[model samples]
Target: MGWLRAAVLGANDGIVSTASLVLGVAAAHGSAQSVLIAGIAGLVAGSMSMAAGEYVSVHSQADSERAELERERHELQTDVEAEHKELAAIYASRGLDPVLARQVADQLMAHDALDAHARDELGITEAFRARPLQAAAASALSFAVGSALPLLMVALTPASMLLPLVFATSLVFLAVLGALAAWAGGAPMGVGTLRITFWGALAMAITAGVGMLFGVSG
Candidate 1:
């Protein structure tokens, strides 16, 4: 689920930002070939950037988690009895009776002291641990895939109708991406789709207007 959110966000940003860039350039009176070239360049750059950024960020987070886990493990080893009491108290605070909490904590500590403390005290779980490489790859791949759609439209569409066609198509793609993201995250699909499309349309519109203004002035 976390990976899904990262992938979707990567893809969505790729699509919206690249589309906006291409539209702005196209409105500035560039040739279709030029626009296509720019779009492709943007896609490649954006994907690589996203991947690198995600990698670095996730790696930092993973390091932090590992450091915390190591500290907890050392604490548990140095003072097992105290750690046990701490775990029991945590459980008791969460509504368990004192005797039952102590028994449960002892049992958990016996099985895996570090795991128990990390999970209960530090709120660190294997399920939520960061994966730097996986996140980076997912971000890069998804960004490239998303960027390709608008780039393809720009390349294949007739120049006479390129702007409008690209605008409309990109909005549809953004909406689809939003709906998919929302569904994956167990959110309201319609609301997510509408929100994405609305913002995407506004960005493209603003870029196009600015481009046209620049073109006329030039």
Candidate 2:
């Protein structure tokens, strides 16, 4: 589930944004065609944006991790004693006795100097390691899937019922998604559901209001 966070976030954004866009246009008394077009446009734009953003962010994290590992590797090559002492100090600070810390560090270094330093010193681990392509794909695919839900409502629902249906359905989807994501992350499901629903409601409300205001003035 390394990609769960990005996937959940991307899907949440996709649902909220496309639903909000559809609601706004519908509130403006736009035709079915206009609403569908807006939703589709929002979906495409949001998916691409999420992909690019995740790629850049994860790539930066990967770069930083690589840089730290390389620095540690160089230190191991040029100053093995210093690296060993530094690692021992880390273990000592973590509550091991001085002698025990030194012994533990020596054992770990003997087994794998680079890995020991990378995990303990640089705080890099296999589980949390950044993968740019994985993150990008997860974000993009999740977004498209989420966006499709609201757009489906637009396609099926009549113009008069479009706003209400999309609003209600989107909120339900967001709440369910939030709860599921929270469960995955071992957090409180209720809190996550409420948080996502509240934001989705607010986004739709604001956008719908704007659309109405313009509609009235025009």
- What is the Å distance of residue 213 in model 2 from its true position? 1.1
Task: Give the alpha-carbon lDDT of every model.
Answer: 0.90, 0.93
| C-alpha TM-score for every candidate | 0.95, 0.96
Off by over 4 Å in 1: none
Instruction: Give the true-structure RMSD of model 1.
Output: 1.3
Per-residue lDDT of candidate 2, residues 28-147 (tens digit)? 888899889989999999999999999999999999999999999999999999999999999999999999999999999999999999999998999889999999999999999999
Clashing pairs in 2: none
Model 2 quality (TM-score): 0.96
lDDT of 1 by residue, 28-125 (tens): 99898889999999999999999999999999988999999989888887888899999999999999999999999989998999999889998888
